[model samples]
Target: MGNCCGTVIEKAGEMGKITLEILGGGEEIGRLSVLVSRNNSGILLDCGINFDENGNPQMPLYVPPKRVKAIALTHAHLDHTGAVPLYFVSSKIPTYMTKATKDVLRPLMEDYLHISGYYLPFEYEEIAKLFKNTKTVKYGEQVEINGYTLEFINAGHIPGSMSVIVNVSDKRVLFTGDLNLAETELVYPANYREEAKDIDFLVIETTYATTEHPRREDVEKRFIEAVKEVVENNGIVLVPAFSVSRSQEILVVLRKYGIDVPVYYDGMVREINRIFLSNKAFLKNHGLLRKAIKDFIEIRGWQDRKAILESGGPAVIVASSGMLRGGPSSYFLRKIYDREENGIFLVSFQAPNTPGRLIVERGIFEEGMVERIRARVEWFDFSSHAGRTELLKAIDDLRSSLEKVILVHGEPDVQRKFAEEISEKYGLNVIIAKNGDKIVI
Candidate 1:
């Protein structure tokens, strides 16, 4: 279980029975991959790239592509779908995801390759080829392949995000890929009502298991107030958001508060939003999205982005490379670091060692200045992941029917903490999955 890769078999002695394996995203927060097999047939969920401590791509130590028959992506987040192209280049398996995910993945992969300035593990041609082989599954439609039935329900984290329910041998396994239970103006809450009746094994994400987030109303209020303060001071408000869910979430928050000051969106977030618009079926509230489209101004090209920064004053700009890695956010940070009047608002979780966390923790500006930016630094807990209370509530809601609970997609300590809470409270079998840990129902 310690190894980062390779095929891990549990209950190997039970020959014809079904089994489950955690290939990635077990004791870590990124690179979500899992394998479910029954009677020689297999389905891979989310072949994603794992980030090293420095937020760079690190290949998994063990991944046997030969056994995989198909890949199903939950969404377009790099942590959830970055390594998908690698599978297309290295293996013969067909990949599955919504059209929106493929639309977002193309430009993101291209950008990744361009920034790294090295030969990508997979080529653009492979991405195209994989798209050709991809089997698009709409939400709520059950597809039966080789005696196994699978269905995807909206996970409410991002556009085209899904929580998968797989049934084999009369047992059901639910794989939640980055879920958000609270409803936002941007997206609707998860559709757990229909799937809650007969869930046997629940594989849930615990990314926010130890914290409590503010209510939607409170979050919008804080965000609007923060923006008002920055705007009144004639300061540029820089929001570092994840390219996918967080960016859209923030946009909805801003619009819901009726802040009509031209909000500019740059980087992959614009492109991703385009994809989301293209795949309207996966979105939670299409009406609200239409309203957002009618109101907001989107920054398209480099020139437009540069002009926005050069002429910045009292406008809300939502730009990505959320962690401030290499996108317009970094460039904007560099430009606005000297201004005491500007404010940088971090609305998403910052992974360790990333530029976003650095800016939040140590307010060092460019050229090694050790002074905090004169502008106010604010954090609003508007995360897409379910917070501690929501997590407990979700578990409590499923307590009677849920037999096995496997915690994944979080740090080891976080998983352990949540697992302990579930065990002590519900008396259910709570398993904190490690990388390569295999569990059987």
Candidate 2:
């Protein structure tokens, strides 16, 4: 939508019916999108891209924007917000998201363009246009729109990550966007107990639906120990992290465990962290976050990159393109992969056919064709999504008036199995949504 600050288009009269449609994020992990509407007045939840096994990114099914009154964004990750500016409609529909998300949206968008090398339909100017129509809201702040009332609360996935409660047609619908209920050193866990008020229907993420992750403390301890073993032996410790949340979270975890090493950060993590730190109000403990990253050094140029590579072990390097598909992480990995003393510690979930998963599962990190690397490769689940226990607990808190549960943003098999489990456990109607499934809530 292109037009801005126009008259509110209201959906009048009784709450005839609330229809929820899956535009994307129905069965797969990426391209999460949905439409909630009644009487032809609708709102967009998210429009992200899903990457195929070949590392190519694709958008979900199209939803016409003419009927959309507004767009609500959960966070700035590409999978959730990538298709926003590209899908332009004549009318400029205002966007609702946390300030941190609005702040980081530019860099992430630019990075997507740079990484993909594909010319998206929109230009850089459109990003500014998108921001112009943005109504940045603080966490837990309630804003009443023409057709719905939305409140964004902390989702604990990253800085400014949120779970949204949309009040439409006298129904409270909660959407948890890549949620984490346990607090990390940098993030505050989701507070559904307070924000999930009078929920009528729940659409939640099922990324970690069937799996239970290791305790945060235990995982941190193991990761630090692995890094320590490498650096202590004069080997370089490389971590390929997601630029948005995972990068900063790893730094916080390393700082928390008191891992004293030359932790050099490369790629866009510095800028993302700067934007995150600038908005202390959106952080769980900004002061602590500042202290956590105080000792780390940011890689500035090719010289710094070269120096770090030459310096070798007894150092820790965190780089972007978390999957090791591209970015400085790949260069660093290539330089050290043949050395047994060097270590590559994966800190997040690796999707199928990606380099990260290739290395973690098969000791290979190269793109396309895989090759054995002598360097150490270890993995610990550093996912931000809620595990089965966390998901159940979040759903339980909102079960009072929760009429239906739609599981999206997960593998089809996981969504189906988890749906069955949830339905049986809570005795609530659960839907394993497909790309175009429409249901009345």
Candidate 3:
């Protein structure tokens, strides 16, 4: 009904009772964790972490580790899996995720610790234990743990990302863990119609519930055109993208659109690309990525970085921390910002207060030193989340069996607007969740 933090919102029913506790990611976009329980045992959905304005790691609300029977990870993104190692400090409960997710998580976890270890509770030992307890599951595989049956289906957000269906006591609850219904060069569109059938409850993400993205083809075309223009004019183009999937997605887009220029990738993107290449089944077309890799040069060390920057000819560099918080992208920006010929093409969401947002909105970069940038900067909506149209369509497809909708992982204003529309159009009960809220269905 509202942002019910530390409160229980229960539907009175004598049979088929299931309880959901929101430990985090209730009214936020990150640090998502949820506990779903039937009877006395519970399953932890995601053990993630959030960042404070000063870039400190903020963990989710605590759920006693003993009460949780198992942990299910939707993907390997830091916001979804960063706090998972903390659970391993005391509990070795089995963690289930896709094989690709497991493989991709190691480098990310290592990097996260290298950056935020001082503020974290767990260490590398716990991370090792976390992996020791991990059990990989493929798409559509149903595995029973304690009293819950979990089924993982492709989420289409990134490679190996999934939506989880928890079945217990004859009730079905679907958790849309950062899903995307839009098709991309990396993964196929998430077709959840078949899996949504007979789902009694839907716990959905509203990351982009208030907006609709432009057609993928149109966006791709425009992005390619802009890149080609920069390359042809003997200028440098830097694309700061997420290391997980966005960086690789952009490379595939460049190849698909026939943008033949010197391409160099820096930061942790090279590691993520290797993980994606080895896990070929999780991708839409791994061959395209392989081909792209053959053409692009990897910035192995400072020597390679300097070589690319010192080159006279035009080149495109793709790097990580899409928001330009702190990565090789930031270093590259400092070198190229004063040049009018260079361009910064941001292909991911720029959260408020990040360097990427500042450049886009105010044409400035303010990390160590504030500088008025002269480089042409543009942002593309290469989000891997379902937009308003896709979200409503998902609800319409599952409306027959959906009784209650609980929205999470969006700003408060966006969730409120989305909740109102769902309530009016579908005439279904909708709840805008906050941290520490429990719901019964």
Candidate 4:
């Protein structure tokens, strides 16, 4: 791995006030990159890529790498880390993320390159170079870059997710990466530390600001019961879940609750599970995780997948792409979707305009669609992000020290309403970040 192979202009841009320039993920939920600058030092919060209207992945517009000491990665999600390898390929800017994040990210980037024809402009060599420059920092570790200190706090959305804290020029700025307030069976909820009590500038994620998620246990129980019903009727239960923590969480929940039916998993879930198990230090219960992995049958070969689908129902099958964005999950659904006894369990959030959302909302896959999937469709809220009440409580808990509030990583309408409500409740005005907008605090 050529860890160091690029050059970038270095400068600590003017001093005094802290500045944050948004490159992406201000108006939308993806491609999260923000430049934090104070005095002569600056760093990127997250450089990610989002999808276009035509269903293609698109990176944020290029920004000069000058004055950026390093890129502080908060997690391994594509929406948070997609642009890293290519954007930094020519610059080789040091990238920082949790050790667990690095482990998961390697596989994600490799998979992305293999599947994406040209979405990722960088080659495999560039991914290796990005890895070489990437430095893994543990949660709560302080990283110093050009007279500034950066710290990572557990974000609880997925394995290795962290909220970023920057300390510079006697001021502290907190950037909440994708936030999770409820502890899942896989990971603990975001930890609100005493250090997080007082903040000069607060950059937070309001992903579910307007929506309230059901209790974690309740959601799991309902989903498991629905699966049990389909299984008892000799129908297959197809659960489309994210290959990361979502797939693992569904597996653990089913097995721990004594669901005896055979459960099978396909797609990248198996590989990601291996990575998650090897890094049990970041999980909630090591024993439970191991048992969950052992409990499920891993499906790797297409022949095996077809065999499982042909075997006919009475079992639970979990696959990737919670939204029907093309993965083994869609195949599983197509196989058993015609039967009224069979069911498609949506155990995760279905992004707007995605196949999953269409099925849930419209009950049809639309023109040129694969089968109508007339089977029963059920939705379960297994979201890992904080909800409206929780978000308000968290903000209120630290309001006494909150000087400036900025919201990111959410839909424009959802965040705008929440921002107005937050400003009224706390009497501190809220700022909504837009693409290319810069706020000086």
Number of the predicted model whose lDDT against the real structure is largest: 3
Local accuracy by lDDT, each model: 0.75, 0.81, 0.87, 0.81
Candidates in order, TM-scores: namely 0.91, 0.93, 0.96, 0.94
The global Cα lDDT (0 to 1) of model 4 is: 0.81
Predicted model with the maximum TM-score: 3
lDDT of 4 at 94: 86
Which ten residues in a row are the worst by lDDT in model 3?
5-14
Misplaced by over 4 Å in model 1 are: 1-14, 61-63, 117-120, 300-306, 309-312, 365-367
- Tens-place lDDT per residue, model 3, 205-242, is 99999999999988999898889888888999999999
Q: Whose lDDT is higher: candidate 1's or candidate 3's? A: 3
Q: Please give me the total number of clashing residue pairs in predicted model 3.
A: 0
Q: How many clashes in each structure?
A: 2, 7, 0, 5
Summarize candidate 4's per-residue lDDT along 333-353 as a digit string, tens digits. 667767789889998888777
Error of 4 at 214 (Å): 0.9
For candidate 2, write residues 143-178 as lDDT tens digits: 877768888888988888788888886788888888
Arrange candidates by lDDT, descending: 3, 4, 2, 1
Q: Decide which is better by TM-score, 1 or 4.
A: 4
